[model samples]
Target: MKKQLTAIFISLLFFQLSISAVEPMKPQEFKADIIIYGGTSAAITAAVQATRMKKTVIIVSPDRHLGGLSASGLGFTDTGNKGVIGGLAREFYHRVYLHYQDKQSWPWQQQTEYGNKGQGTPAIDGTDRTMWIFEPHVAEQIMEDFVKENTLKIYRDELLNRESGVLMKNGNILAITTLSGKKFIGKVFIDTTYEGDLMAAAKVSYHVGREANTTYGENWNGVQTLVFQHQHHFATKIDPYKIPGDKKSGLLAGISNETPSPNGTADDKLQAYCFRMCLTNVPENRVAFPKPDRYNLLDYELLVRVFNSGWKALFNKYDPLPNRKTDTNNHGPFSTDYIGMNYDYPEASYQRRKEIIAAHENYQKGLMYFMATDPRIPKDLQQQLNTWGLAKDEFKDNGNWPHQIYVREARRMIGAFVMSENEVLGKKEVPKPIGMGSYSLDSHHTQRYVTPEGYVQNEGDIGVKAPKPYGISYNAIVPKITECKNLLVPICISSSHIAYGSVRMEPVFMILGESAATAASLAIDNRTAVQEVNYNQLKTLLLKQKQTLNWNGKP
Candidate 1:
């Protein structure tokens, strides 16, 4: 009996020790000259530039991976003008080129067989020594190389305590604490998150959703009900009700019941989010699309209706990447984009955001599964979809699915200066140019609702071409001098909704990241606010760094 009791006591003691090992983390402190929040392409470039400038920087990332959408299946880059991309951004693509130069990089397909597939542009720019199109893993590897080469300090999986994280004094951030009880003190901070969490936490001014076209005197700033630039809209009229023509059957699974704001009006709606899936038709490297656990036939009723009505543009945007893989993005209406589902994501708590992200993942997975296996789909389309599957080697960590969701737009900062349509279209000359954007002003559909004509329609999809490469102002990055003196936002920049569509490219983010870091370092050295950095000196240093501040209207 005594032996038995002693054994139980020993087991209990061991269990207690195990519990202590998993106890809540105690607060720990770290100090750095510059602290960057968000593990994005912008964040990585910012840290790399700061390190090169001889400043101690730490990346307080709330992610396990470093790169954002760039490493997360956005391999088919959307560069409008390769000439405008320079500095660290161009270096990243050059590294991608070097990676492909090694013959061994071609695993599923030979380099010659893949040929040069890009969006009406050469994949490899010979003169620049940069390759714009690449595989998702290849992009991630390049970003990993940057972190490894710099030996930069990155605190992965450390989320900021949004409620009471930032400690500020006299218009300066003193320290920021993460939810895991890690506190980082820094002289200057940069927020490179797509969601602008750090900037929002610092009480910086920002705007979410779309602004009225009149607010900025921009043609593509708001509700674009009449604009149908892409073929993403429904090809024909499809009923949104669950029971086809019966309104009493209630609305379909994905269709919203709310009335859309008038054309060119502002609303709280945000663009749809999706996983830019990396898929492949190569048999050896393909993993069949798995039906999600929560798959419901009722959820995809609207899609079936569209298919039944003779929609055949489902595979339009399967953009080709290296290694026989494709960057499968949202193409037609009722596709991968989970419309009207992510409106609350910008300000959602971590746990809530996780739920939103998971929902998006499930939605996309179910979409692929339905396309491949659902008998309701046209037999020809089903057969074609069955030929493709998720790339087995890509996103291996998360069941062969992309780990990042495409946050097309989020909380845009309302800083000292906001880039508007006039500046983007070369109507107004921007002062103190730090970078340039040439991509067309593009905003994805924000809502899918029933139209007054008793048909389902998408709203808020806008695409307006910029006349030429335009300068991005330094003031667009830094907060108002009175709001925060030490912070810079690169990803969620201060811009009108229409202008952000042009400036939110990954290359532009990296360019702005480098410039922001350079400005931060100068500010720290000169003992001045980010807004007070001399533009002439900043411009000189940027030019010295080989950054392209203006386009000479040449390819």
Candidate 2:
């Protein structure tokens, strides 16, 4: 008994000592051939492709989950055409397929009886391919497997020091200091954040809002009052005013009440933002939405008003992923979108980012809690919502809440090539194809405004189908031929804002990520800048990797 007590006491002491030994954000240095800054689908693709090329790679992500939205709960991929998906990105969905081969994976669907709805490049449910729609944790597990098999090094929760921290020497990044003061050294770097935080820190030129239509000769660019997509049209077509016909009631919670005049003028505003909530009806895996501490009922006054306006189609955008869970997102006006509220997020600091996150959480939680329990909602809609809850098996951390919020649109870098509407609509072909996108140019719920009659209306949610599988440009991944010369990119970093609207699909990002990795490796081998890398050589390499080139390339 005495010996056991001594052992237990010594164990406790060791545990405490080990815990104390962890220095508070030490500036440790490490070397790698490539240093990827995010756990996004593109980042993973880059890292995996680099490993295949025998280049040492590491992913330094501030978050623990990998594959960004792909792994974070966006299993219902927003791909426009599956034909454009290929290489590592397609392989990912194949792995997702393998996971479902086991009967145990289908807790809701009967094994061998479930209908397969496979489409796109990987055909999410094809016999030889893995399914695309997946739970958050399953995506994480796949990423972990990829990392483990390739011996890819990943440092989780390593935050970037947004200012004066990432040290670039002679046009090439030498070292980056994280917020915790850890230093990471690499030959080449890729910025994969939805916010482009690291790229901005590196002094890359980027735009934050929709450009006026004249900026890129883009017909669909800027001030798109005439072409709203999706289904978030305001019910009353309210005018942006405060007093109704009297024009005296202060403008509602949203609306840049005054429309900006410059056709292509840039602004510090973006589309909409929402948490990709993971929900389930399985009793064993359901977690009730927790009403946050600062739950202001008044913040949702517009939503309450919206509900009262008879717009109670609650299941409009509850998109399902794998594992009987859903990547439930915002739909019509007054839905889950936090419009006109995230204008400052692109350039905000950590504390500021947290503030926005908290505010969004409050807005979303209150919205859900309202839908499920609010007395004002229609009886049938409320009853339907009551059947849903956060999936117990997904996002096991953070109370099953999705770790990623859809940024929709943010800072887009003007790179070696800027993709425009012409390239997207195939009015003209993009010169160098590195990737493809097929999702309709989809943005979601931006605002609510007061009408001429004192009623409210919604705006900004758009969803336009493209003509075909449009090729994404390789130059979109690199800084201007005159700007930083050693970088390669894929995470919605290149292209004009409207062009990015269609190019920002997850499968496309993964394809671009693989292509970016290929370019980065080639640049390293040839001792040349990313902009100077031979396109023909890059194209050949991509073709070898099963990437569809020229759109007409054979499968």
Candidate 3:
């Protein structure tokens, strides 16, 4: 009987050990020729190009969903000069065209009902077989289809262990371990995240915030409180004090009490961030904007004052998308952009970043709720806002809200050649052209401060147009040879603040992403560092892939 009891106890212990082994997660080990460390549109294009070049690639993304801003609420694509977008970037838009061609793709509205209304151009380019604008879900589906068709390996919800994630050997990244203990080993790596997290972890040289105008000989680089080119500025003088005229009553919330920075000087303040909300007017497909859990009326007292002071351009940027939806963005002085609240985001811990993201969501949602329901708002404006609601079919997993917030600018790699405003404005020639960017050098407000006259004013809003489609050099996307040998930074390419404003567009990012992957493939073939890749050979391959390296004056 004693022997039998001992046998039973041993059997139970073995069973318990087996169960524990299965329950606890072990570090997943993966190896590939190339590792792309972001889920942005640029990352997707890079992975696709690598696959096309017949190289093994894996995407380790911090995001649960793929396609960063493209899959987010930025459905109104910002394609500056359509002719300049090519290669896999153009292919992605062509796929969007194909998706819309099918009648089954339109569920909420008919194809005919939604006419061509894009960013000052037709939505569909029949000759090129590309569509510039699309719904959020459609973009997500296209990216998923790319992964399925190519059979690419993707690890989602995996964040980089920023402290000790990157393992380097002689300036080459050998492996990167995630917070979850997943280890990804690769021959070549690409950092395509908006925040340049992987690049920063790899000890690559980068810059954060706006550089001085004199730093790169650019006029739109630093503080611009005096230049109010857009209508987002204050139309009338309004008191910045909480008690209307009494300075002793203290400043109102969200208004900075500090003096403006001297123009043409560097500052650490980053551009504001906001959600490009996907809204719809269709009753069946609309979800009313929910009142955020931490909603506070006092937070928006300034906006109420703005409305009372004759600011009526609330719906200036409700850009249309397919299926009766709108890509609503920050418009007037106080809108979606959470001003002066994201200065620490670029270097914040993951937990802290999550809190910031939540705060932005809450603030924007509360703003929408205030505009639609608050009694202080003008009745006409309130009625107009009431017509729009979150698209029910979009972002189903995230309570009918966008899963990713718009990170307009983040850590920019200080690479071999830093593209500045001169290059973008066609005043300087770029060597070994790989891509092009033609968007206006645009920036949103950085802070709201009280003018010397005691009136509230916004600072750091500038929009200077690029002269034409300008070449982005190969050196811009590559790190310095001394910093890292095998890494490429496409999304956060080396550029001054003013030049980055034009290059930060989604199409431009995708274009550079494809170019970066091409360079990576060439480096792998030659067994050389990414910085040493032959520009002539790289240019040949890029042209063969149908990438537009120059404008060619087609229009």
- Who is ahead in TM-score, 2 or 3? 3
**What is the number of backbone collisions in each predicted candidate, taken in the order shown?**
0, 21, 0
- TM-score: model 2 vs. ground truth: 0.90
lDDT of 2 by residue, 197-225 (tens): 77788887888877777778876666555
- Choose 1 or 3, whichever is better by TM-score: 3
For each candidate, give its TM-score against the true structure: 0.95, 0.90, 0.97
In candidate 1, what are the lDDT values of residues 1-555, reduced to their tens digit? Answer: 999999999999999999889995567999999999999999999999999999999999999987899999998899888888899999999999899889999988888888776654688776778898988888888888999999999999989898999999999999999988899999999999999999999999999988998987877877788577876888688988878789999999988898887788888888889999999999999999999978887888889888889888888899989888998888888889999999999989889999999998888888888878888899888898889999999989999998889998989999999999999999999988999999988888888888888889888777788888999999999999999999999999999988998898999999999999999999999999999999999999999999999888768
Which run of 10 residues does model 2 get worst, by summed lDDT? 114-123
Q: lDDT tens string, model 3, 1-555?
A: 999999999999999999988898667889999999999999999999999999999999999899999999898998888888888888899999999999998888999998887784589888888998999999999889989999989999899999999999999999999999999999999998999999999889999999998898888888888678777878789788889999999988788888988987889888899999999999999899899988999889999999989889888899989889999989988889999999999999999999999999999999999888989999998998898999999999999899899999989999999999999999899998999888888888888899887799998888888879999999999899998999999999999987888899999888988899999999999999999999999999999999998889864
- Worst lDDT window (10 residues) for model 3? 226-235
Looking at model 2, how many pairs of residues clash?
A: 21
